[model samples]
Target chain A: MTRYLLRRVWYMLITLFIIATFSFFLMKILPGSPLNAEDKLSEEQKEIILEKYGLNDPIPVQYAKYLGGLVKGDLGVSFKFDNTPVTAILFDRIGPSALLGFQALVVGSILGIFLGLMASIFRNSPIDFSSTIIAVIGTSIPSFVFAGLLQYVFAVKLGWFPVALWGEFEHTILPTIALAIHPMATAARFTRTEMVEVLHSNYIITARAKGVSESGIILKHGLRNALIPLITVLGPMAVGLMTGSMVIEQIFAIPGIGEQFVTSVMVNDYPTIMGTTLLFAFGFIVIILIIDLLYGLIDPRIRLAGGK
Target chain B: MSKLLEVKDLKVSFNTYNGEVHAVRGVTFDLNKGETLAIVGESGSGKSVTSNAIMRLLPEPHGFIKEGQILLEGVDLAKKTSKEMQKIRGKDISMVFQDPMSSLNPTMKIGNQIMEGLIKHQNMNKQEARKTALELLTLVGIPRPDVRINQYPHQFSGGMRQRVVVAIALACNPKILIADEPTTALDVTIQAQILELMKSIQQKTDSAIIFITHDLGVVANVADRVAVMYAGKIVEIGTVDDIFYNPKHPYTWGLIGSMPTLDSTDEELFAIPGSPPNMLTPPVGDAFAPRNQFALEIDTVMEPPMFKVSDTHYAATWLLHEDAPKIEPPAAVKHRMQGFAQTGTKGGGKR
Candidate 1:
């Protein structure tokens, strides 16, 4: 098990290194200046500005210098925003987006599992049919569009809550629902599919024949086996929501790292972009690793088979 | 031995998109304590359906008991609500199914599955159930019960897994243990071993077993009584001696003649001609009439009632009717029966 974990961490480091190298070159290739003070600075002053950040060095030398700084946990500085450290900017803005994404993740995944389990248990009934339809609509629409619809229905028509912004619980609810709909739907659909298959399995029949109650069978046997495939999707779904929250943040006008990321990209802020890419990639890699371990926990057969 | 279970004119059907399939049509039997009643038939002849109906384990809203009384210790199970049935199951009656590879919960420890019934039905606490689970594993011929109890289903081999399943079924000492083709999915060697194990275990518990299977060879090893089924009904039922020594139903004769004996030296093994009739629209007459060579004219229009051969034997065929032709069973059956009678009894099966 430790070997499995060690191998995953090794892969994570390699993935981060590749993303860092690729993003560094990709940023250099774009036709824009990170330091936009060329007009105000004399030629010598501009040279000083470029030399201070090692932009005047050859690409390889700059790349080597950046790697050297990365080793020391210095993610460089943002050019578009008053030359602030990339780590500082990230640390400042991480809270709001993480909270919103986490909120959406909890709401969407919980609801989806409930709906999927319901659909699978009472299969072909009206509840199953309607939940399936809802899941379809959720998967088809983008989060922004979903946000707009939620806003329209709750904010404009019903006058139940605030339309946008983030502070009070009411303000976060609309955006959270919008962000969660797709995952909730994905989870519902996948859970339904997997739960249906597991429920029909021969073991389930044996459980019923042994006179285990229906709820006990569904919970202990049916849901546990069903969650394996569901686990595969959950990791990616959370990362997608965390990164996907950028567009959502802009629409709802929430102050979050998502807005910082959007502005950094628009203005060609290399350090901020590199930092954001590495952070999100790191999040994804770690989540996938956790999911791999969860597989062993849920099904001992997986670990035993793999060990053998 | 007192009667343990009784089924009175049980009928089961499955409602499908194509319409209702009358799977088991008015099958009746009684099981006595300390006995094994083997239900034998070709596939789709309702052997499995009849067993599942007794357990009430048939899939719902589609397959159900159309009409019947499943009287366990004189209580009508058919009239009980599902909540009440849950209490009856696993305590009064437990079942072992075919396909051992798929019958056990993969995520659960084999020990827990065996313990579940003891905890639920026998009212044992976790620690007590755990101890009994180990004892059950040992009783079913599983080696190293303490170590094996902690292992999952996939950790065990196919035959070993079946033994574990059997251990689970026998845990609570059910009044009747219904095993639906428990060895059909196993290897031939494993099939014999499992039957041997079941016979040995049967002596230890008073639980009357209803062993459902298609293999007559297996029936000889484990069954005290045999019921040969065709088109969802019992065509012949009698003590092992009566069915094997003086078999009368044409279907039963066909079954016996088609069997591959160790001593028989036939160039081609006889196969029962034609498939079982589709149960979607079952025929009005004896369901086996079309396939029977000696089928009388009346056999096409009317179903024959069970005819008594002896106090302990019965067969559902017009050939047993007085005034009908005194035709003997086919030559192969007479030859096999004569050979079997000379040998005295099946070797190494009786406890």
Candidate 2:
């Protein structure tokens, strides 16, 4: 297992390398020079600015320097943000984004699994019908629209919450819901389908024949098997939650990595853009690896014999 | 012999989209204490359904016992509430299913799976249950029970998993054990071992067993009384010797004739003609009439009542009527019966 994990980590590093190389060069290839806004200054001043940021160097030389700095754990300085190290900026913003993402995931997963189990247990009943309706509504409405509507009703109309900010736990309510709604719906739908399928499995009939209670058959047998498929979805869902949160963060004026990343892109802040994009890619890859490891633990067939 | 379980005119049906499907029609039988009764039938012959109905384990919204009295030790089991039935299941009765691998939960340790009943029904604590689980595993012939008990179902071989399932069924020491095709999924060698194990276990526990299967070989080895189900009802029921030699039902004759014997050099084994009737719109009269070559004219218009063949044997066939012509069994079946008699394996109908 250790060897297998080591192989996976090596593969992940190679993937990261490809992503970093592409994003770095892709940013360079985009129209509009980083020094375009320097028209307000003299040509000599512009040249000085270009020299300071190493823009005058050839692309390959700059790429080599960037790669060296990356190896040394130096992400250089943000061009638009008063020359602060891109890593520092990222660290500052990541806390809120991580907290928000974590909150969304925990809340979404708990509710999804609960409603999914309920939907399966009371299949073809009002509970299932209502859950399907809620999932449809949750998935159909855009996160930004939901965020805007939630802010208007809960914050502006009724004055129950602060409209836009990320100061306290309370401030995260609307944006987190906006970010979580769709993925929560998707997870719930998947869980319901998988649980229903597991409940109908031949093993469940055997369990029942063994005189196991209905609840015992479901909680102990059905849920564990159903969780395998649900676990696979969690990896991509986490990435989607973080990436999808950019819009919600912008709407709520939250100081999160998603917000910072978006701002960096509009102004072409090279260091910030590279750092955040790399961070996103890293987060996605690492979560997927953890999910793969979890699969081996949950299922003995997979653990004894590695994934086929 | 004292009765262990009795079913009176048990009828089970499924409400399908098209109409009601009579899965088990007027099936009735009795299991004696400490005796193995085999319910022999083809698939969908209502053998499994009858067993499931007795346990009240049938899937709802589709399967239901329409009319019946499943009496266990004089108590009508069909009348018991779900909660009341729960008390009886795994405590007074236990069942081992066909597929051993699927019978045990994949995620659970073998010890935990065995101990679940001990903890739930026997009221034993975790430590006590674990110790008993290990002992049960050892009794079932699992090697290194201490270490193996911690292992999950996937770690064990197919034969070993069947042993684990047996160990679980024996955990509660149920008075009545139902093994539905327990050896059907196993190879011949493993099947023999399991049959021997069940026989020995029965001797030790003295529990009545309802062994449901389609294998006559298995029935011959393990069954004391045989109940042959064709459609949803018992076509013939008698002592094992009577079923093999003096069988009265045509379905039983077909079943016995279909068996491949070591001495026989026939090109192809005899197969009963025509498929089983569709249960959706079940036949108006005898369900097996279409497939029985010896079926009389009355067999097509009316269902036959169980006619007494002996003090302990009975068969449902128009041919068994007193006025009906006496017909002889096929030469092959008669030859096998004569061989069986020559071997002196036929004991009088007394245990």
User: TM-scores across all candidates?
Assistant: 0.96, 0.96
Error of 2 at A129 (Å): 1.4
Scored against the true structure, residue A255 in model 1 reaches a CA lDDT of 84
What docking class should model 2 receive?
medium
Instruction: List per-candidate RMSD values in Å.
Output: 2.2, 2.5
lDDT agreement with native, every candidate = 0.88, 0.86
RMSD of 1: 2.2
The DockQ scores of all candidates, in the order shown, are 0.77, 0.63
The candidate scoring highest on DockQ is 1
Q: Residue B82 of candidate 2: its Cα lDDT?
A: 76
Give one digit per residue, the lDDT tens place, for model 1 in A179-214: 999989999999999999999899998888778999
Model 2 chain B weakest 10-residue run by lDDT: B342-351
DockQ for candidate 1, please give it: 0.77
Model 2 lDDT at residue A171:
95
